[model samples]
Target: MELFNSALGKNITFVHPKFFIIGGLTGIPNITFYYVFLFFVYIVSVVGNTVVMAVIYLDHNLRTPKYIAVFNLAFVDLFGNTALVPKVLDIFLFGHYYIPYNDCLTFLFFCYTCLSLQSFNLVALSYDRMVAIIFPLHYQVKVTHRFMFSFIASLWVFTIIAVLISVGLLTRLSFCKSVVINSYFCDHGQIYRLACNDHFPSYVIACLYPVIIFWLPLAFILLSYLYIGYTLVKVATGEERLKALKTCTSHVILVANFFLPLVGTNIAAVASYIHPNARIINSTLTYTIPALLNPIIYALKTEEVMNAVKKLWKKKTFINTA
Candidate 1:
């Protein structure tokens, strides 16, 4: 770990084509330029997510539970992107691959913690939508400010405890020298790969934690929508029914697209633990593709988000014209 800050850290040991894809596509082969490219992504994700949150916050007309849920989701995502991207961009720019031991652990802890929080937030949002569609009158009282605040507080507490326990368990192990992470960030799975001791517990925890947290909520989201669709069919009014159906459809699509890749990646990570080839495929789906596609997914599926973005853009243009 002491070698992290030494001049030797500047020497590049490995350069894979996958890591240089952005540089290749951009026709700029310089390693320094790749750092700039990653920073561009970091800036776009932060700005776009921040705008989403701000739109939800400033627009009193958008103060429903569904949109409030979206606001919280965007807020968590903003934190998520910030926690991971800066370190990654810094490593690329400075040509320093070594992180101090404590800093490495801290990075892994918070990154996974934020990732857990974001996934849980998605689950909560799905439940909120489910209630709104399945029982409109009940949703107001059920998903009130007080209730949501308590719910979010509980989620943070639970996630922190789980992550701390996982980290404490991890801390007991010693890391050997094979530290070049195939993934951009120091993810828990990647970090565990370097552990010199028995890794059964780490693998078990990694597989079980995500499954319990992500899959359980995903099951609920799927079931809730199925019931919602059934109930919608019984409604009498055509226009009112269409409105309810449209909203439910949007929520279902968003939930599926988000959870499918997430769950698949988690499972793939387990397989990758055994087979090296699987890790590369999982890396592409988990890191590269999902980061780029999340905003596009929301825009394509949710008219509300699309309209809000358009409104925000037109306002920006008008201000510029003035």
Candidate 2:
């Protein structure tokens, strides 16, 4: 309230609009097809993550710190899509672009939290990978179940704090100007920029959040792998090196799937002009596809998970036959 009051320095009261019309892709051609595609992605994401979780729960062999992290990844992927894609369908497909102010904030909160956690979950996987290869003998001691669980919990706490602060700050702004948000969702930047008063603080957050959510986590993962590579080269034979690196294939693919597009999008935004619709499509796909792929990658690429899945299938078949 103070933040809003402070900005209300004039004779008039602050003007906060009742609703904001999300202006993202509203004018694009054939975007309904994209929305339909997003719905399909959401369904696949839900089913895939559920199967991953089911396999983990059913297979005792997967009850390790690493699979625990994988489980977290699957869950985050599931939640992120559920929070985002459906609302997207409702807004664009069903023509409910006018979102109430409070609902917009809630929408931003869940979307950002899950997005941030996706990156952190990658960090968790990277930590497990780093400890496993770099300190092979002490991997168990270093990456215990308690440690991974605690680490993930701490990450959630931190991520929630960051996202909440962003949401909380939005309450202080008075949207006297345009109420139409320019992005594909109730974007933090689009909403804050609509404020009629001082929004420097929000601008600062806008600059800082990408670093926290994207770059910092990304650098940590990359550096951890670098150290793992160094340690591997120092001690292991060529055959052993390939074997160690093989374990990282799924993580690498997932990381690249999530981060590279983000990096590219940012770079494209900076280097040249991009159609708003094109940017929206790129951003939406970048977040969604990796989620759909996460469980599939684990089920197909990781031998343990593949074996567990096959075993589950065989068990189900035998029981039905018997």
Candidate 3:
């Protein structure tokens, strides 16, 4: 056992002790109920996102540059949720609580990548809205399919590269002790906290990464909306102004829904006084809640999506009556 531990430790600097998830520690009287609730949420998120993508793809009218961004956002939500939630369920329900060291790092990489992509995609959506609202005359000329495709490609490439660099930096850290991560899944901050070596550089990068990935895009979205607001005010027609405002509102809601929980999760993770259960719940919600809500928010709030859904429902009802 000593030789096996030594060999494994030599290859991978740290092997974590079996980590306890927040869901398991929430002190709920009936743990089975919590697992059932989470399982239901996971199923809803998957089905909801998949339906959004299908609706967008099947409806030829909805396939605009703007909806393309929406489609991509839904895709990210689905991908991100799928990547994290199953492992969380495994930990909570199946008692597969101990994640191998390398597996944890791999999951962390994809989670961060999805988060970065989601943020960048939101920024792209803001830009799409900005152009459509502020420069409607030139929007067609400016925001081409080619341009949107290239922009999305660039977002994926950039995020993948950034995550790679971050993971590379993480690899350099030594974890001599088996630490227990308090949260569900492998949260970046929680993983970083477990490192036995000097974490100053990792800490610096971790702090800066959220700023670059989350806040910077958030700032861009806000600035774009500010200009959008300014442009809406100058519009002479009340009808046009209302229409423009309605278009941007959904994007704004989605942005808030995604970022607020994200920021809150980070805060709860770092704040010493915050309960571990709260941090875990926050982290779990940060991924699952957004995934479940994205489709519902877009479907209800965005006019095109609502119309498409109505049309599809009518078509199905008509067929049934026939």
Off by over 4 Å in 2: 1-14
Among these predicted structures, which one has the highest TM-score?
Answer: 2
Q: Please, what are the lDDT tens digits per residue for candidate 1 over residues 246-317?
A: 776655655665677766666766566434444443443343333434555566677877777788789889
Give the alpha-carbon lDDT of every model.
0.65, 0.90, 0.79
Candidate 3 is scored at a TM of 0.86
Every model's TM-score: 0.74, 0.95, 0.86
lDDT string, candidate 3, 250-288, tens digits:
888999999988877777667775666766666677767
Error of 2 at 136 (Å): 1.0
User: Using lDDT as the measure, which candidate wins?
Assistant: 2
Q: How far is candidate 3 from the true structure (C-alpha RMSD, Å)?
A: 4.7
Question: Candidate 3, which ten residues in sequence have the lowest lDDT sum?
Answer: 17-26
Per-residue CA lDDT of model 2 for 144-169, tens digit only, reads 99999999999999999999888877
Clashing residue pairs for model 3: none
